[model samples]
Target: MDKMRVSGDRFVNERGEQVIFNGINLVEKDPANDMITPGGDRLYEQLATHGFNLIRFGIYWNKVEPAPGQIDMAYLGRVAAQIQLAARHELYVFLDMHQDLYAAKWGDGAPDWAVQDDGLAFNRSGLWSDSYFISPGLHHAQDHFWANDPASDGVGLTDHYLHAWQAIAKYFLEADNVIGFDLMNEPFPGSQAQEIVQAVLGYAGQRFQVTPDQLMAMWLDDTAKQKLLAQLNEGDTYSAVLQAMTPAVQAFETQTLNPFYEKMAAGLHDLLNGKALFLESSVFANIGVPSALTFTADNSLVYAPHAYDLVVDTNHFESYSTARLDHSLKVIRATQEKAGVPVVLGEWGAYFNQPETKAISEFHIQHVEANQWSQTYWSYYPEFFSSPTAAVLDRPYPQAINGDLRRYRYDPATQQFELAFKTLPGTSRIFVPHLATVELSQLAAQGMRADKRALPGGTGGVLFITADREQEVVLHLQIG
Candidate 1:
């Protein structure tokens, strides 16, 4: 397959065929481990067998540059070997410079030397994300990094980051099946951390009509923080709270996060010319907040955002609520449409062990299908292909289309798949995995006919169809 480029809310290949990316996030993540192993090759094969066509591969800064001014060729070679392995399986890769709370000392991404905390407390508040709200040391380190404050060696953090990115780009610029870089994982605003937390609390309180004194109590009292944490732990959506905080968070994204992205784009100008730059919004946007970031003229830009309900991490999937899901989809789609860029749901479905996991996964997949959007599920670790979640995650879909796709659906119970699209000169193909027999005799279309062919190595089959120019086509297939 040729390289993909963004074209008006869709991704098109060099041949102008619309391409939809369906894949998973693959990351060894630990710097002490090899970048790619024989196990990784097996995993890639499993992904291909499950009909995945791409991978949002994680590459950490701590691994690539263990120290200041040093580029680890061994690490780069491992990454390259993995890229080659992905190519062999016909899977596209987008390197994600993955990070959590900034450095390896706290979470991941930056090298230990780059962390510039001022001896502040690094306590955890039980929840992994609460550190962002409570850790002064984390806040200080992030603030310094964002401000590009000088390290012990006097080099600015952003400058070092730029160098790291440049080195990565130089290594992968001409590599096969390597799409581009996901500049940053989830950008957290660090300046005025306490004030920002207070502001959000105040906003949520006001929405709940709490008195000023009560709001102040929530901000100042540890008991109140515990109460709030209890609510979150109990699977409270806190919809009113999140809604109230949306505007303030969006403002932060506009004033702080977007500028950071702009800087990264400017720094990577030469290296990312024809490659897709996958951009993610602030962490708050995962809960239905609007994104104010836009890259209007940069056709290589892709709005790659993560999605999760507030109840995420509670081990019980929030019941499938269309109203809740629709709100998030609407907000994100509005942002993408406003920016005139295609969207790829970068990280979702971390609820692997949740009781409602399959339902939630199906809900997200349904939305992706309806929106004609591309997606990479949050992870492919510990290998859960035979788990209940796999029933929804591992399914068939149209991989490439010759023209605009109208809609598609797959009913797990019936083992029936349907797709609708407007026709072009080229052919359209659907990936059907784990099917011993596929019946396309009932396939219905206005101007297209379908034929079933065995996939490479006969792991599965693909239903190939050719459509007349300007004709609308629909296909149906049953698996037994």
Candidate 2:
């Protein structure tokens, strides 16, 4: 439960040990549940058993401030209770102010008082996200928010959001496990979204020798959707589309999103203390478009981007493409290099009840390990406890490294976990899930001593390792 801070493009604990956050998001957008994700000891205990060390906890503006100039202490108390529960299991928490179609009226984010639609019309679609493209009301609402329009109290909507963040940070300042705050979730470009979409369509249209209108119709058709997705899977095709959207994406990120983040950071600077600020790219950058977000090196800032396939929400496993996912992640990684900050992939794997996504999960997990980046999967569901994906999720990972981590990987096929790092002065810890039928086998160790101790619930055991000296250390172990 040590406080976390960015250390040269990595997250290090109070002890200065490298920390890798791996867990799931707990977002309960439905107001019917009182705006809190339902869980208790059993949930957090299970998460710990599965080797998860972080939770991107979701909070909503509507619940935090039901009315302008009012802070919802009661609602925050409920949220704090949950954070305390998670902390009991040694899980880190970061508050994510989540949104979808701009406001709670359409999705779950801004309060009703904060929405200014200019009386534009809104029509719901079968796929809730389609509203981003079809609803003029949603566009106008977001445009007003980005413009920082004055509310009934003569306060700007963005200012009100900053006020909400200040109150939340103050409430959780004492919660050691509550590490930081995610400024926003998947910020869309409001009316400018149309421009990006049109640009992409135009780029694709030229390739297919069709007009943008024709391509739009094709995108709307179910059968044509698969073909378009396949076409995009082609390396050159996707790259060109991303190239076409880059200009607009860069414009919005530089002109609007960058300033918004800076304003939020400035507003919260005095209160942040050791807590970090989680920054997310525009929704357009979620796929593969390179983010043009620029920031001076600051220890408190973390680049938290979300990656999703075009076929994410729908159950189209056959249409899933690893190439596309890899391409998108590579783009985000480039942005991280430019921003010179650590990355915690805020959202991924919205597989939702799909038992056949184990391969997809494995690919992503391996990619994350290879890059040495932190991640919290898209969401949590009861099915996660007993799904094909669960087996993949409950794998060995370094909880903390005493020094620079060169590499780490867990090959499920062989039940082997390997790690290489340059040794420092602290004891390194790795989470080894408890196996019902077999004990752990320390196949080899080059320059370190290893010990295993079981956790209270038999969910897993922490493999404690200490280096022999200040040099490169390698470990090879297996759980079978």
In order, what lDDT does every prediction score? 0.77, 0.86
Q: Which ten residues in a row have the lowest lDDT in candidate 1?
A: 228-237
RMSD of each: 3.5, 1.6
Candidate 2: list runs displaced more than 4 Å.
435-447
Q: Could you say which candidate leads in lDDT?
A: 2
Candidate 1: the clashing residue pairs are: none
Residue 214 lDDT in candidate 1? 77
TM-score of each: 0.90, 0.97
Error of 2 at 212 (Å): 2.2
Candidate 2 local lDDT, 253-329, one digit each (tens): 99999999999999998888788999999998888889877776768898999998888887687687898899998
Model 1 accuracy (lDDT, Cα): 0.77
lDDT of 1 by residue, 299-398 (tens): 8889998887645554335543445556777788888778888888998877665566777688888888888888988776574676656668667898
Q: Cα miss at 379, model 1 (Å)?
A: 1.1
